[model samples]
Target: MTTKRCTMPFLRACAALAGVALIAGCASAPEGAAPKNSNGWVKDEVSDSYVFAYPLVLMDVSREAATGNAPGQAASNTLRNAQSLPPVGASSPPEPNLDTLVSTGWLDLGNEPVLISLPDTHGRYMDARALDMWTNVLWSTATPANERVNGLKAQTIAFVPAGWKGTLPARVKRIDVSTRYAWFIARIQTRGGADLNAVRRLQRGLRVAPLAAWDAHGKRAAQAEAQSGAGLSGDPVETGAPAARVAALDANGYFNRLALALEDNAPVPDDQHALKILGDIGVHPGDGAQLPSGSKDMAMVNAGLADGRTRVATPPSNLLAGNGWLWIGDDAGNYGPDYSLRAYAAWASPGLPTSRDEVRARVAQDSDGHALNGANRYVIHFSAKQLPPVRGFWSITAYTTDGALDGDAPVRIAFGDRNGARRNRDGSIDVHVSAERARGGSNWVPAPKGDFRLVLRMYAPKPQATDGSWQPAAVERQ
Candidate 1:
């Protein structure tokens, strides 16, 4: 017979009845005293609790980094638009998209609602989304649940606090957000370097402002010119990227940050039990300023930290894996009870859009399930009947195992419909992958001379692609 897993509600009830004294002892006991719980139990709880809090902590640190340290017009309620595509081989952001230019900003809803104004895309492909501090997608143009009439249409939106009643412009739609902080990201299609100017024009048309100023009609000269990045106050977070900085934080630093973040980004109902368990280890919200000082307790904390990092680095079971490929879909961007999957997604792609907007699949092995090496030539043959199905488009990009484009590659690092890859007479497409140019470079995707991987992205994918009714062909050694 299978054993049932211990549910959080049961754990909470047990803690209330018998574990309260033990928890108080754990919290107030001297560092050198024997641990209130067994070493293994403490280690497991610490790791699990850390994973539960990872997304919020990461999101908070990322906001500080982006709004304070990033260049351009990055600031609270102001956008930092990318003037060009990410440089080839840039490793700062893993798996950068080559199809669109990005614009990002943060919102502060503690005082008032923020207004976002968007211009029409005129049939061009564009997507925008807003995520709460817990990394839950509060609103997305591409998510069917949002009921956006036209994701690319000219529109205005007001992101208001959960209980705030406000008067917005007659045409502005109001979206209630539960957190005091939110993140907004927008992407506009760009064909290539030559097409950047057009995308920039659209980017310039986007605007963000405070709802009060907008209602007053003056708009404070557009919120004092939208609080130019130059006027940004406060010392930025440490110099490194947010993810790296978060990883480097110590036990006290990390847990304290989480405690402070919870003041604004309150936990959802499902997180109550997890929060209670965290208190047993003295990790209560607003009270994680100090960690246990005993050597034995510190060792358990450190081990738990290392274990949590490893668990998040490993792929979660929810990913759709097949034919040597792994991917995520509709389940991403809105995880409710799956904290492991949520942390994994946040670590993998901090600003990932909903699967309805895009689906990304990666493969590091060939048809034989061997690690892909650039020394061997390969081909991904898509039969005419099996071509990727998408409403927007699809592309396959080659990257080093470390997730960087090959700097030494002579030909393009990616190939797809946009490249107008040559097709066979049977209407099938054969995408050649090799270190050397293949078939005179027609539909050729260059690879590094060592280990490599491939990423397949389908934007606005059709139902078949996400439902597993359709799958990309395996990569065969040539």
Candidate 2:
């Protein structure tokens, strides 16, 4: 009989060969590959996946930052009130409006429904906007269709999670929220420093709490609890500020967080195609995603992230453009299934955006096609018949090129109907835009000492303003 020997080296070599073959088989591209120069199906899939997940990722990071454990920080079920307006040149929230005092809070609906109570505004302009995890406005008092009492009557609102069953007070309006977490922001109009006390009183009147807590302690006790900084529990997520958290995340971290968020906050039915695309790449709600291991797969995902970032920063063709001004269309806040548009809005402005009737127009250049700088004077002339059509009011405000309030501008940086602008003999209004104070007081909108832009706000705008029939006057250099 022949002696058969199995050497250690031969056994090791066989195992190594088998491993290589298995890896090669797993990495092989699918059949029917794309032609040359085309971003193959893998890259396309990666691109679509990033776009589909950007908003959710962004919101998750923001929620973690806002509710995480920290000193002087309110927990998920409490309110945090901003007693005064944001400082000039506050980059945290670009283009901070001087018109209102804002109070913000995060809601946790996992346990039970929450109650929101608003005091009578006495004809003052006040709004409470609640956003879901995806940044969609779940409910807003600013929307005419949803307004509770026209700023004249006290109101109570109960926010319940999907499939929640309970009997609510007949007087309390119920709003259904899809996600377990919700963000609330209340804005009360402030005339100036002199009117701050009144606004503070109004802010104090805004209350939020769990339905059971509110029912047990009552509205006054709930408000006192929120103010005392009590009853806030520790947050489970560990994260920093929203922007910092996003920057710290790698491809794996970002995708993992997105997967987890999707598990909690299910996507709308319209997003089935996107969900399928994600599944093909081993990413599914409630399942820990397994990313492809090949170098080419990593490269495609990184490239897709870059592409999505660019798309969000660039305005789409549907934006309203006229005389160097650009603004979103009538579909400002209520985005149904337009992922790109929704992602862009979340990236640019994180809070609940104003509705179509509240138009916000921006201008970056003068009529002569030059970048707007404080070195030169400019004028925006609106004929009597061409004035912005708005039932509420109109105003023009200036900000730095990066969207911060121009700190160099005077305290009264904005001017419009509230300023009681002076009109010329022909009934045309000439708005002076310059670093130096203009001759006329009411029609002057202060500009920064360097490059700046203008935002024209028209609240309760008419059809002409929204339908693109009425265009803002050109900014002509003097």
Task: State which candidate has the highest lDDT.
Answer: 1
Can you tell me which runs of candidate 2 are displaced by over 4 Å? Answer: 1-39, 143-150, 216-224, 228-248, 354-357, 410-412
Judge candidate 1 against the unseen true structure and give its global Cα lDDT, from 0 to 1: 0.73
Q: Per model, state how many residue pairs clash.
A: 0, 0
TM-score of 2: 0.84
lDDT of each: 0.73, 0.69
**For model 2, how does the per-residue alpha-carbon lDDT over 106-160 read when each residue is reduced to its tens digit?**
8889978888888898877676778888778887775563343246368888889
What is the per-residue lDDT of model 1 for residues 1-478, given as tens digits with 9 covering 90 to 100?
Answer: 1112224355334324322222223345434444555565556566776787888999999887777544632668877676766565655566666777777788999899998888788777788889998888888787552223234777888899989976767777789999899998887877776777788788888888777667544232444445333222111121226778888887778889988898788888756767775775677666655555578878988887788878767786556666778776556677766777678878877776777777888899999889999999999999999888877778888888877777777644458887777889999999998989887769888888899989998877777665555667889998
What's model 1's lDDT at 269?
Answer: 73
Question: Cα RMSD (Å) between model 1 and the true structure?
Answer: 6.6
> Candidate 2 overall Cα lDDT vs. reference?
0.69
Lowest summed-lDDT stretch of 10 residues in model 2? 231-240
